[model samples]
Every structure is written in structure tokens, then in C-alpha cells.
Target: MPNIEYIITAEFHIDKGPSLVFQYPHQLPGLQNLYFLPELMLPDQIHKRNEDYTLFLLYRNLNTGEFQYLYNKNNCEPDPYFLYTIVLNLTNDEYKRGSQVKSLSILTNLSFFKNFKPVMMICLDLYFKSNDHHIIKQLYKSINEKSFIISRDSLNGMEINDISLIKKLLITSILDLPINDKIYYDENFRNKILGIGKSQIINPDLFIRKDLSFNSILNFNEMNIPIRIPMINLPDTIGDYLNPTDLNFKPNLINILNSKLSSSILNNELTIYGLQTPPIIILINAILTGKKILVMSYENSSGYIIDHILLILKIITGGGILSGLLTRYNIFPIIDVSKIELLEECDSFIAGTINPFFKNNDKLWDLLYDLDLNEFIISSNIETPGDNIIKSSIISEDARFLSNLQLSIFNYNDDLTTIQLIFRRHINEIIRILLSSKNFNNNLLPNNKDLILLLEGIGYYWSSDTTKLLEISCYQLISKKFQNLLYNEKLIYNLILPNLSNELNLMIDLHYHLQSLNNVSITTKINEREIWFNILKFLISGKSLEIFLLITYLIPPNSSTSLQSSIAHNGNITIFDKNKGIELLLINLFNFDDQIKSNIIMILQELEDNFLCGWCINLFLKNNLIYEIAFNELINT
Candidate 1:
């Protein structure tokens, strides 16, 4: 896909103030005379800094008319046509004519648009000097023609085993090597490591890639400049451009409140309803249940608080389920009093404001989070639309889970990343169990009686409002067939579940492939050593749990293996070997609840008693020692 959809420049004039200077290729459909164009380009204070950068989002509405606040009021599903905007400010007296500052921006649908920053910088510099439209035209042509170094088509096949093989090929090249994030900006890893003798040992054509590749350098002959893609990226990290690094990203939810706000206005009251429930729990519930959220702070800039809130949302959902759930399209990171009327036109959003006037009008938001007071102010006019009796169990479950997480977080010396993993896995587990429910039929729609049971059990009410929200939630990460059925008939069965069965089965297949590997002596080549390290890294990665869960879920009496014959007890089959079974179980033992843990102990005890399978018990003991060392290293780091 093309990275740059449109390029435009905005300038601040002493007489006319902020206005669009020019748009490349063709003018954007409805951007001309946009009410918020000034805000998009200049932000709060553009002249304060010598140079500045701002990020914003807009939808591709082709109206080309007056502002319509109610455009997407009915549907909250992610708009597939959302555009991310990056504005680069050049504040200097060198600019021509009536403006001292000019803002250059690229509007792209890519969440990884940060990669194109270098290109943007050069383009802006060149445009400033030459004032040639052809430079922008050449950039548009070159970016669109750029292709992935490796074929992405290898992952598009129907057979997951084939996809798994492709993943193995991709991951193994990066295997056993501590990711050199430096590679994202420097010369290629192969070129950096390979001397004359080493070059012969390693294949020159072999590709070593990362989860995100930010170092893809592009050359524009027309402009006579080369630029490397930038490093920073948006929250959604699962894309072709993802560049996995050695350093693990640990987002601390407790520290989500802006330091400026918290330091100045720290409050003892972090609860609601006279100290019964934590405000965070209420906030999570509000977001999950599809309520309009407005976070208000009178402190300096609203950007920090807004960014932190977005980070909190991203962390809670693990960047997987929330990818298409809510995005920049659904948020206004910075809001002022002037946009209040437009904000009110939308039925739902999560907005941040420095303006105190928003608090005076309670009807403006369904849930108002006051950073100054450290309180959650639930609007009196807003209420959850469902039977309280039926919702009790669901509410309890959510509260129990979140409260446990909150309590455990503060009480432990454990790694914050580990806690994040546990939180994410909990969410994935919920999706897995929901999709595996017997209440849903072959068509993937739930039966009425069982549907209500499913809904109530998972904390949803059976109503039109819930259904609409569900429809919006189900739009992303689902098959086209499911999406088609959902759009045609608004329903709950398609809600929030990401075809878990297929994903789990893929993990299982990948596990089977891993087991199929034969033991071999370590190779002497640097490339071979690098591959080994990458593999080990993958084993310890947070994402590795997907494959690990397949082992945990099919343990005890149900354990089975590909190399060995499937062991059956009471119609359930266990797959894989005893050593792998033990390794997998030990790796994710913490993720399992009490009941599952108890069953695993019983199964291990049975293996311990049998003289023939006694070696399995010894292997388990041996692996546990290695696991402890690795665990301690992970925590300490």
C-alpha cells in the first residue's frame, strides 16, 4: 500500500493567520475550508518553539461542504478510511512573503507513518528552497512503487502450516540474536557483520528482518536526496513496518496520569461512590461499555494526559483487540472550547481538554475524568442501558479481574512487562472462551436463549444499544464473511471475538512444526549464531504465549503429541511429547488458574509414579531450573 496518500503545506500569515498554503497532486476531498484546519496545522502555540511537530487524525469525508458533527453518530465501528496526519513545523524568518512559519504534513492511512519522517523532512526542505510541485509528485510516485524486500504473499495462503513455515523462515533468520535496534537506522545487519572471510560463510541474499522495519532507505533522484525511515510509531504495532527491538516495551498503567497533573493536584481520593470502587475500574468499564469519555485538565498541555490515556487503552487491550476498536478517528487528543459544539455532535468519543468550561456542562460527556481532582465524575444523565439483575455477574467479573490486577500490580516486585502480559492474556482468554461457547451455532450467531446467557455471563446486556456497540467492536480482525453478516444484520455473536479457534489452531500447528525439528550441533557461522539467538528470543517473547497456550490448554488427561501417538482418555486427545508438555506447562504455569494448576499437578504426579515415563518427571525438574534462570534474568532486566 502507498504510505503517503496526500501532501500539503500550511502557513501562518501575519494578516490572515493560519491557512492551507498548498496541497500536492490534488486537493483533499473535504479539507478546504475545514473548520479545524487551523487547529490541525498550528495547534495551540506554533510560534512558541523554533520547530515543532504535531499528530492529528481525520476521516476522508467527501462532502466538501460545511462541518457535519453528526456524520458518523450512529456507527462507531472503525472507519476503514481514516487518515493519520503528521505536521512538521518550520518556524524561521527564511520563509517567503507574509509568513514566518510553514507547516508541512503528510496524510497517510498507515499507523506506521513515523517511518516516513526523514522523507518528509527532506521534502519540506526541498520545497522551501525550490518551491517545485514536481518534487512532491515524484515523492508520491516513488513511495507507491516501493515494495517489501521479502514477499509478504508467503503469509497469505489458506494452509496455516504453510504460513507457519513462512513465519519460521522469517523468525529463524532473526533467531538467537539480540535484536540490534541500531540496525533500524544504520547499515544492514549483514553488511555490518560480514568481513571478507565471514561473507563467504553467510549467504549474501539471506534476509534478516524485524517485526517492524523502520530502516528502509528511500532515494529520490528527482529531489537528489536519500532518507531513512524514522523510529517512533503509533500504538498499533502489528503491521508490515513493525520493528521488534531487544528492549522490551513496558507500559506502566499506574503511571498513566500525567506527572504534571498528578504532581500539582495529587488527591487522596482515587475512588468513586464514597470510596467503594477505584476510579480506574469505573473508567475501564465506561470504555468497554461504549460510553462517551471526556478527560479534562486545566494543567499546561492536554497532550500528555491524552497520550497517557491512549497508552492506557492500548496496554489494557494489548494492541491486538483494540487495533480496530478505537483509533485516532474516535479521539480528539487535544480539544479546546471552540470545538465543544462539534464534539457534542458526535455520539461517542474519548477527548482531552485544557479548557475548564467542559466541566460546567455535564451533558457534554457520559463519563468525565477530572485529572485535577483525581475523580471520576459519572454524568447523572448517563446510565448503562441494561437490566441490572442480568448485568450483575458480568460487572462482578470485570471488577474482579481488574481489581485483582490492580491489587497484584502494587504488591509485587515482578516485572511490569510480565504483568502486562498477564493482563493481555486475560483479555485473549476471555475472547477464546467466548468464541468457544456452545451457545453460538455454525453460522457464528448465538441462539436467543444461549445468547442472553452468553451476554450476561460476559457482562453485556441484550439491547439495541449493546448490539450496535457490538457491531462496531466486531468490525476489525474478523473475516469478511463475518463482517458482511454483521453489517447486514446487527448482532452480538460477531462482537469482540477474533476467530480464536483458527488462531489457536495455528499456534498448535506451529508447535507441531517446532517439534518436527531434529537435534543438530550448533553451526560456526555468525549468521547461524544470529538465527539461534532470534529463536531463543522468540521463545521468551510475550507473543510466544500463543504457542505456549496450546500446550497448557490440552494438558493432563487431554495431552497429545505429533511425534508420538495421540493419547486418549474419555474421548479427548493429548498431542506432543512428555518433555515438550512439561516445558510448555512450566513456561505458562502462572497464567493458569487454581483449578487448572491443580489438574496439572495431578498429571505430573501420574508421570512421576510410572517407571516407564519417570524420565519425563526428571526432564521437568531439569527444565524448571533453566526456566528459573531465564525468569530471573527477564525480571531483573
Candidate 2:
């Protein structure tokens, strides 16, 4: 032998046994007798009757661990012979000599062997495990292909006997095949090997056997699978997985709570005012329990305090209680309780102005009453003005508190003077906040009665100064909400119309917006003659003639002709004097045919005097003009 290498070993068991057969390559003349003749391998020696032999070659690439097969006979052959040749790679001689003979066995009963004849040929190389002569002889003797045609019931009994071993081989071989190979792409073979039938398989991991044990399922779970969960960093005060209190809140638990809260809010299970209440309660409880304490000096405390106070005000104004607090105190007592000590502990304290409205007001004071003056003094050390607090006061129901707060913050010489100035400065901010509030109504002026009272009081105090009061009131009337208030006849004539000026563009815009309101009677509030006079004044002012002409055309036809004639004559005298008269008159004549007819004769006379008659005739004739009878009469005149 040429340096005998590692032997391929395989075992096959069939119905009849104890007789071995072997095949050798043609080139190995010394082993010629070991090769079975074609007639002996075939059923009933059919090759003796001149039937062709179908040679099925199973080729394995030892270097790459791949297998493929091809048949020698062509498709035209009526009864082809089937011969299977399996190739196995050789190992190094040194290892082959030292290694023990290892065998891989495939067990199948005779019926299974016959039913799976093609599979047997395909898996031959994989079934063979060792090249040891004794092992090869033993495997060869164990497989008796001639006795493989057992009856159906006997085959069923044999299938049960060998199912475990057969299943292992089938699964291993199927899994080992290259994924993109044609053999691996055969769906029927794949399903059959995996024991899938009838219904579709859902979990591929459970393909081997449906009755897999819990441990096996767990093993599958441990295998790599694609699943993703997005991670977020939470504040340390929220706690960790082990201890789920605020001191050690788990991120997952907080995420779950947030998800639930968001779902409730989106589904409208909670009102807008109730949106932040739960988080506020959680924060307050965390502070009270000493799980988390927010420590800040008065300089930086406004953001935290302002947000909580706004929530508290909204809850109280909306007729809801701050659930866990004592009934004797209002919602914000906790601020004084916790903040005073924190403020005192800082290195230096800067005493800025806290809102004066909050200091002695009955509602807020009743909440702060339990606190000592010493604590108030300490907490007030670094108080400063915050715009958020002022904005919040816009919607708050407590007018007295808001007034007091404004007076304290601005340090005005008198309450009336301070409020008048504040109103002038923050009017836009106040109106914007009021319009954005949930309860705002377009038909009402100053929808909140509290805001109405505040403005009314300011107006009353400043009644003597009509100029300043009128300016302050103008801001309110121009706002959309206040414009809606003018739907009331008395308010339109008495309050709003008095404030509007006769400026042309402002009046135009107001007229345009007012036209959309079917409920308001515009003619009752506006003097038509005066508006027309102002519009005519605008036309003669020569500021915006196009707008003037547009407005003139919109007038009732009986009223517009005189206005158009006046405009055209004015343009003739002044614009013609400036030598641009013909162009201007022609523009008007083309744009407003009905409105400018009365002025055409005078305009044409101006054109004749300006030496533009020939130019106008040539321009019209070049464009194939057809002169109307009235236009011809104007020209003739």
C-alpha cells in the first residue's frame, strides 16, 4: 500500500446481514476481486439481460468538506441501473497510523432503506466514518440491500425502532449541507427530514421534535437571536433594579410607569391640568421621604418653584385638590418647608424680591401660615423676579394677589400708576397667554372674569388720563378675542369704534376682517360717508393709486362713477402737468372700464393737449382695437 492514510469509516444495517461486499477502483488491479460485478449488485441480475447500469457517483471534497452527486446514465434509458460510488478524503499517514479506528453508524430497517434509497446514496459519504479494513468489512456485512422490501406494517414497526438514530443522521446531514447548494434548497426533503408535515412550522428552533423538554427550550433561548431594546439613561434618584423605591428605582420600572402615564394622557383619561400632577406628586413624595432632595440657592430656585406653583394654581383654579396635602394648607406649603433650610445653609444669601402677592395674600398665606417668620426670611434671601411668574398671573383667578405681586415687584410710587405702566408694557404678553389658555373663548373679551376685573380696575384708576387709557385699551380692542367682543352693539359703538382711527390702510384691514362676522352689524358702527371721504382723500393724496382705484370700484356703481371721475381729473391735471398723465390715465381706463367711463372725455382731452392723441390712436390700432360707442364719443368730444 502507498503509505496508508486515515481510513473513512461507515456502518449500515439492513434486513439480511453477516456477508460483506466491497468495490475497488479500476486502477487498483490487486483489489479487483473485491469489486462486486454489476449483475450481482442489481435486482435479479438485470444487467445480464443487457440492461444498462446507472452509476451514481457520490463525490466528497475532503479539503473543503463538500459533497455532490451525478448519475452516469442518460434520461433516455428506459430501465437504468443505479451504482453509487462514494469518495472520502485521506488524512496524513502519521496520524492515520496512530489513530484508533473510529466508526459512524447509520441504523435503518429494511423498509426504511428501500423507501429512502436515494437518500442512502446521497448520504453515503457522510455515513462512512473510518477506512479501517475490519470496520469497513463489519459495516458492509451489516447492510443487506436485497432484503429491504418488507411489508408496510413491518416497516412501520421498524421505523419506530430506528427513528431516533435516523432522525439524528437526517438532521445533522441537512444542517451540515452548504446553505446555497441545490440539495439544501429542496423544500420537501428539508421538511421531511425535520419531521414537518401538514401544518406550517412556526418556531424553527422547535423543528427537530415538537415535544422538546423545558431544558432544551431554554438552551435554544440562550442561542443568538436578533432582539433589540433601546436603552436610556435615567437620573440616579430614580433608583436601580434591586431596590425599586425612589432611592433605587429601576429604569425599566420608570419606563413602564411613564409609558402608562403617557397612554392615559393620550387616551384623554386625564385632563390637561391633571397631566403633570402625578409627576409632581412623585417628586414631592421623593423629597419628603428623603429619597431625593433638590438643594438650590434662592438665585436658581425660581424654575423649580415656578413650575410647581403653576401646576398648583391650575389644579386649584380648575376645582381639583392637591390630593395628599393637609386641608389647612394650600398646595405650595412644601416649598417653604423644604427650601428655607436649604437657603440658610448656603455660604452667602442675596435677598431679592419674592412676589409680593405671595407674601400676605389670604390663599397663599394660609398655606404658608404654619411657617415661622425666620424661615420665610431665610428662604427669601435670594428671591428674584421671574417672567414665568408674571405670565402665570395672567390666567390666575386671584386678582388681588396678582395686583399685589405687580406692585411689590415694580416698587411703584402708587398702585394706580404702577398698574397703568405695567399694562402698557406687558399687554402683548398678557393677551398671548390669555388666548393660549384652554378655557379661552373667541366671543368674549377677556374671557377670564378675573382678568376683566384687573383691566377694569386699572382703567378706573386711570380714568383722568384719556390718552394713556386710550392707548392701553387699543391693544385690547385690536386683539382677535377682543374684536369678537365687538359683536355686542353697545361695545362696538361705545368701546371699539371710538378707538379706531381714520387711517386708510388700518381702516381697510379692519373692514376686511369685520366683513367675515355675520353676527356683527358693521353699518351700525361705521359712518359710511366719513369712510368714503377718507378713501377719497387717500386717492387724492397720490400715495397708493392702485389701492384707491380698487376701493373705488368696490363701491356701489352709482357712488363710484363720481369718485372715479374725480380721481381721473386729478391725475390729468397733476400727472399730465408732470408729463406722465397719458400712461396713468390709460392704466385706469384699462383696469376699471365701468368706473372710469365718466372721466374718459376729460382724459382724452388731456391726452390731446399733451400731444399724446396720435400715440394713443397708433397704440390702439396696432393691437387691433375695437372702440366702444361711448369711447368713440369721448374721443370725438
Candidate 3:
């Protein structure tokens, strides 16, 4: 059992905002104590009068003082007793004289207090001096039914106070109290307690009795649905490839497809041995149009064929275009010939390389022969099985249109089997279109970096070939476009120079090509500065010593002077003034490890006799290069 001693007190002042203040004299012995003052706004009638008020403090607790044994046995019901009453008479002479005679005191034994029993309640009555307004306010409110005691004694006799439980009980008792109807109906009182105005309160009974529907509240039939407008107007040439029957076709899909098709056409030429035969755009178009497609290849070639097939499937299923609606259609990729039974269920079959076992096996061959040739599209690399070879037909009409357009432009022939030849034939036209495209003008080309990288690939692919035509073609096209695009000097020095070529002569040739442009004005001084900067960048990137030595030999002695002049011109400072370039280089040198610092020291040593070397040496001497101290020690010896 647990015990609690409480001397609870409350005071009401007419002038105070809260009007009522409650206090507990004795700390609750072991249980948590909670006091609640709702602080609700009093009605106008209560505030208007200077009248006397009386509050009856009614407490109902059974007396168990003489019935201890009965309480222990839980056998007898205890008798209830009235605790006390408090009075406030503002009209009294003492109150008029500012003595404030409003006070209440209660002392009682509540040893028999139990849970789920009404322990206390308060009744308030306001009386006016005038007979016109007698009993201006009256309220009978119940206290919490649950006793304040949270828990009884445990084995260790430790009491854990649960303040939250007490607070919840007190709040529920306060809300359940029957306030006067006048106060409950008052807008101000309702707002103060419920946090909502009377007009905002919904009446379920009123709504249920009335006939109402969504259509009655809103004129749905008269509402206009807004139409979506495309961001860009697609050209009719590419628009012809769009599926006319696709109701779900959207502008964004058309834009993406157009961009891809345009980029592919600009970068690659149509060829029989192209990595993606029939083109990815054509495959997308085929799926969009619900056309049947068959793909066949040998087991060895199946992997590469399947890769392309999976890429298309991923595009469709990933909701890049049709929002995965194409998955509902019958589409399947048959990789294993053993699962030939599943092929009958598919509207289209992407038949990968036939297993080698079927080559000599008559039974398997017969089964494959039974597969409709019209529904089968064979890989270009594999030889047709029967005397009447089943040539893969273009399933989508739009795909055929695009293919014909490519063939007409490039003049496809046996000699033009390689992508390089096809690209070479269409290079000039591709360049013209790319340079004039909206993406090029806006600098929003999605694969601009990829296009630049392709130039490098082309150059390397034909590096050992006796015929340097393809490599030269790649260089010319890249050089022409990059001349216009390389607006940022850092971009040209960092990205363009290294990727142009590994050969010293080719790099020099490209630099000269940029310089020789009629519109371009790359001075001898600016060119020299860029060359040294590129060499430094290359060396820092961990290039071989051979390349570094070659670059060192190629760099003119006045390269540093040229750099100083360029920096001076840009900053509008004299070249003779303190060298910012050397300061910047010194700052960067601190970032390098001891090994790289030593390498830089050696490079500077090779150029020591040159005029630029004096500035570099001064920089090293002024700033501590850690390696500088080691170099000085070696020099002194």
C-alpha cells in the first residue's frame, strides 16, 4: 500500500486573467500529482457584475479510519462526507475596503479513496445584489473518477510516478463536466475551449437529413479539362516514325526518341555490321507500334544479341517511353532452343544463337524448320539455314522509312560494311546538322562528351592502319566543331589537348589548326602558355618520363615568359610586377607529395639555364618546397 498527503488550495481574484489559481501544499508522497486549470474565457454575464460568488467544494470519500479490518478484507462500503465550501463576497465591506476576503480551506482524511469512484466535484453560483440577475452563473463539474494514486507497493517498495496518466485522467474529467448551456453555446467560450468557431463545427444530423451529393455541390459536367501542350514542335520527318495508334503517346516520349535518333544518325552511319543492327530507335518504334519482331543468332553470338534485346526491354519496362504498357503485349526473347515450346506463345521471337546441338540433330532442326520463317529474324552474322534464306523483314513501317532514308543518303554497299566507312561517307552532313541543331545552340546536347569521345575512338581504331583516311577524317571533323565549342581556355587545355592525340606532332598540328582559323585569334604567346600548362597537367596526371622529356624538349624557352605576358594582360598588370603564375604554382606545389615534388625539382633543374628557370628557382627559394632544402644541400656539395 502507498500513502499520499495533499493540502490542495485554490484562489479566485476578480481582476486576474486566470481568475483562479490552484496550489498543493504537501508533495504527493509517492504518486505523481497533476493539477488542471482549463483557463476558459468566462461569459460576459460573469464579468459584468460586481457581485458575491460562492463555490461549494464537494468531496465524496468513504471513511475507512475505524474500518481498517473491513478495508483489508474489502468487505464493507465506506460512508461519504462533505469536505468544505469556499465563498467570495465582493460586496462585503472588507472586500470593498480592498481586504480581498476570498479564501477556502479544506482538510480531510481520504484513506478509503479507490479507483473508478467519484472523489470530488465543484459547484459554482453567482449572486447579484439586485433581484433582476439572481444566480447569474451556475456550474456543477465532476473531478476525475480515477484516484490520484498511480500504483501500489512492489516487492522493492519503489514507487514510479506516472505524471502523464494523471494528466490524461484530469483532462478527461474537465471535458466531461457539464458547463452551463449559456457558456457552452457562447462563441467565445466554445472557441477558447474547442479551438474552433461555432460556424466551423459540422453538424452530422443536419447533413444526414438533407439530400446532398458531389454533383449537387460541384457542377462536374460543366467543368473544362485543360489540354496538355508540347514543349517543342517535332519535325514531320521524325514525326512520321511515331505510332499513330498509340493513344498514350506523349510529347516527352517523342522528344526523347527524336533526340536519340538524331544523335545516332549524326554519330554513326547505317551499316550491316553495325553494333546495333536495325538501330535502337527502330526497335523502340517497333514496340510502340505493336509490331512483331523475330531475332535469331548462333549460341556464340547470342550474348551480344541478347544485350541489345535486354537494353530495349529495359527501356520499355523502366517507363522511359510507354509507361510499361508495352509489357502487356506478347513479347519474348528466346535464348535457349530447348525452350522452343514457349516460342509458340510469343507474337514476336528474338531468337538468339541456335544451340550447337541442333546443327547436326535432325529432330531439333526439324522443329526449328517448323518455326514460321516470316516470324523469325536471323542475325546478320549467321548464315541462313535453308536454301531459301529467311531474310529479316522490317516489322515497323516507320523503321523501314528511317532505314531507307539512311541507305539513300549513305549509298549502302558491300564495301561500306564497316561503321567507319558509313560514318566517313556521311561525316560532312552529320557535322552540318549537329552544328545547327537546337541542342548545339543551347549547349544542351545530352551526349556531347560522348560525341567528342567517339572522335578519339575513331582515331585509335585506325592508328595502325596503312590508310590514315579514317583517322584524318575524325580529326578534321572534331577539330572543326571543337574550334567553335572550346570557348573556355581551361576546357581546351584540360580536356581537348590530351584527347586530341598522344603524338607530339598531332597535338602541335591541332594547336596550329586552331590558330590558323580565320575567326580565331590564338596569339603565339597565348598558344605557348596553353602548351606549357597542358604539359604540366599531363606530367601531374602521372604520364611516363618519356612523354615528359619529349614535352620538355618541345616547349620553347620563352614559354614561361609567354605565360607571364598572358597573365599580365588578363589581370591588366605589368609582366615585370610580382609573378602571380609562380605564386599559384608554388601554392600547388605544396599539395604534392615528396616524390612528385622531387620530380618537379628535377624538371626545373633541366630548365635552370633558361630565363624562365630563374623565376621558378626564385619561387622555390622564396617558398619552402621541402624538396627545395634537399636540392640546395646537393647543389652546395
Give candidate 1's whole-model lDDT: 0.43
lDDT of 1 by residue, 564-635 (tens): 233222221121232243454444334335444443344444444432233323434554676545434443
- In candidate 2, where is summed lDDT lowest over 10 consecutive residues? 229-238
Note the Cα lDDT for every prediction shown.
0.43, 0.25, 0.27
Tens-digit lDDT string for candidate 3 (1-637): 1122222224344454323233234332221211221121111122323322121111222442321110111332322111222333344564443323232222233312211011121222222232211111111111111122322243433222222221211111121112223223543542322222333432221111100100011111233222111111111101111111122223222222332221112121121222233343334323433333444334223223333343344333221112222222322333344345544454333233334443333322211211212121222322222233112332222243344334323332211112211121122222222232221333332333323311111111111233234333322333333334333211111112333233232232222222122112343223323433343333322122223322221111112343345444664222112222233333324433554444445545544533223433454454455646655654455
- lDDT (tens digit, per residue) of candidate 2 on 98-215: 2211122222211111122233332343334433345333334323312221111322233211323212211211111121132235555334433334454323322221111100
Off by over 4 Å in 2: 1-297, 300-362, 365-496, 502-637
For lDDT, candidate 1 versus 3, the one ahead is 1
User: Whose lDDT is greatest here?
Assistant: 1
Question: Candidate 2 or 3, higher TM-score?
Answer: 3
lDDT of 1 at 4: 71
lDDT score for candidate 2 against the true structure: 0.25
